[model samples]
Target: MRILVCGAGGQVGHEVVNRAPGFGLVALGRNRQQLDVSSPEQIAREIQEQRPGLIINAAAYTHVDNAETHAEQAYAVNRDGAANLAAAACQAGIPLLHLSTDYVFAGDARAAYRESDHTAPTGVYGASKLAGEQAIAARQPAHLILRTSWVYGVHGHNFVKTMLRLGRQRDALGVVSDQIGCPTQAGSIAGVLLELASRYARQGTLEWGLYHYSGQPSCSWYDFAGEIFRQAHELGLIERLPQLSPILTAQYPTPARRPAWSVLDCSRFEAAFGLAPRDWHADLGEVLVELSRLERRPLEAGVRRA
Candidate 1:
């Protein structure tokens, strides 16, 4: 099947693009002057050029804090851009796999947020993403809107890479601990999208609904940071173990507010597709092992698996 992958350089986009050999893939990004999603005409043009059987949209204004200050840009890219893509996909008679966020929730729920959970965005980024979600839902009859949380991968800036970098520079670090969420790897999400898309191709049904996609187990930001650093420390890349002091959300002030509980329940996705969600720690270890190879170093003393 032919597929069009937008935001081809972001974490999720990069993973999708890298795994595109299974499908005929047309990848585009902002850096490529040929592709500008902000313009509806351009989006329509690209869709026509690719004429893909599926469109996977991974593009969005993702800087949570920055979105607070640049609400217009965020709205234009996340809301209007999504609308443009959905309209173009509808015109082309194709299903779209749109990646959304869990920030749409208000974060007060004691249980994991399900696909049917009520959305109450607490900040500009969340609000903008929610708008994009609604736009896709309004127009596409056979779209897969995957709402994921705490996504990280080998590509792009994410908590994992950031922690690794800081772990090397500073002797100790203060990571926020109160915020609990899942640490989903982008590669895993890409694989799931492929599986779902192939299944749809065979059955020819979009199913037309939202689903939560995340790692099986959940954790706090501090827990994620500690895991990342623990793997890094094991790699012998850093001289000393950085202090991972857990702090509250307020201690780490930001322009945008994040949901205290961003964990997404993946039971619906699993039941629909009959695929199992992966353990985040397992993927985390794999990523760190790859990092060690990239760094050309041996595993350090007392190094635990990622």
Candidate 2:
């Protein structure tokens, strides 16, 4: 089956492209240069040329802090780009799998967020993503909107990489503990996408709607950073462990407000697909191992910036 993946350069997209062949899929991943999601014309041209059986959109303006100042660009890519892809998929009669974020919720709920929970985005990034969700739902009936949180991987700039860089550079580091969420691995998320794509290819249709998926056993940023350091030290990527300080979100204010509790309830997805959420600690260790293997030479040079 032919699968077209947008944002091929991103962490999740890169994983999807790299792993697609194992699933017996012919995947054509396009970066912004090959296919700009923000441009309807370019999307149409790519779709027409590729004629893929399935479409997975991983493109988005994901910089939460920068999205505040670049609201137009955010909406253009997240909202308009999603709409364009969904509409094109609808026209081509193909199933669309769109990756989303957990930030769509206001994060005040006492328990984990369900797919049916009321959405109240607290920042421009969330707002734009929510808008994209709405646009995709309205434009295309055959679409899977998978929302995940705190994604980190070897390929891109994410929380795990940031923690490693800081842990290597500074003797001590402070991370926000009050704000909590699932630290999902991009490889895991890509695996989920591939599973759905494979099913869609075989069945021709799926129970298409909104779904929530993330790593199991959610933790605060401080806990996540500590775990990263622990794994890095074990892998010999970081020679010395730094003192990690647990601080409140107020201590480190950013341009955008983050959800206090962004843990997603992935039961709906598990029950529907028979795929259980993986433990994050084991996944984190795997990521650290891969990072260590990839950066062994660089780490030998005294920790180069990723």
Candidate 3:
């Protein structure tokens, strides 16, 4: 099957493109520069030209704090771009698999969030993503919206990379402890999406709709940072482990309020897809090894060591 993967420059999109071939898929990847989702004309032209059997939209305006001030830009990409894709997919008689986030919730729930839970996004980024989800549901019948959290990978700017960079530079660091969420690996998400794609290829349908899929055993940022440092040290990706201090969210406030409880109940997804969530520790180890390999590569001009 031919799959069109948008936002190919992002972490999840990069993983999807690289791993698609192993699933017997022909993936056509388009970065923002190549196919900006915010531009309807560009999306229409690309969909027409590519004629892909499936479309996976990993494009998103993910800057939580920046979205507070840049609401228009955020909506342009997250909301309108998603609507455009859904409409085009509907017109083309194809299915769309779009990535979403746990931010759709208000973070006040004590229990893990289910797909049917009430949504009250507290910030612009979350609101925009929720709007995107709504748009897809309205426009496309054959759509799958996967809401994930704390996504990190080897190819993008994420919490894992930030922790690794800080661990190398500082002897000690503080991370927010009050906030809790699953640290999902980008490669694992890509693998799940490809598996679904393969199933759709064979069956020509899916029990599609909104679903929650995240890492198992939720932890705070502090805990995630500690794990990253431990794994990186074990892999020789980090020379030494940095001292980590757990602080409340108030100690580190941002323009956008992060979800205090981002844990998602992925039972519905597992039941529907028949795939279980992989242990995030194993995924973290794999990411650290990949980062190690990248660091060991001969550095070329304009390429800073990761």
- By TM-score, rank the candidates, best first: 3, 2, 1
Best by lDDT: 3
lDDT of 3 at 207: 94
Worst 10 residues of 1 by lDDT: 23-32
Model 1, 1-306: lDDT tens per residue? 777777776888888877766644434333225566679888887777767788888888899999988999999888988888888889889898999998999998989998888889999999999999899989877788999989988778988888887987888788888888998999998888877777766778856689988986888999888878777778775667888788999998887888999988899888888778899999988777776776663345445545
TM-score of each model, in listed order: 0.92, 0.96, 0.97
User: After TM-score superposition, what is the CA distance of residue 174 in candidate 1 from its true location, in Å?
Assistant: 1.2
Displacement of the residue 273 alpha carbon in candidate 2, Å: 0.4
**For model 3, what is the C-alpha lDDT against the true structure?**
0.94
Per residue, candidate 3 scores C-alpha lDDT tens digits across 193-235 of 9999999999999998999998888999999999999999988
Clashing pairs in 1: 172-243
The reply for model 2, stretches above 4 Å from the true place, is 297-306
Instruction: Score candidate 2 by lDDT.
Output: 0.92
TM-score (C-alpha) between model 1 and the true structure: 0.92
As a TM-score, model 2 comes out at 0.96
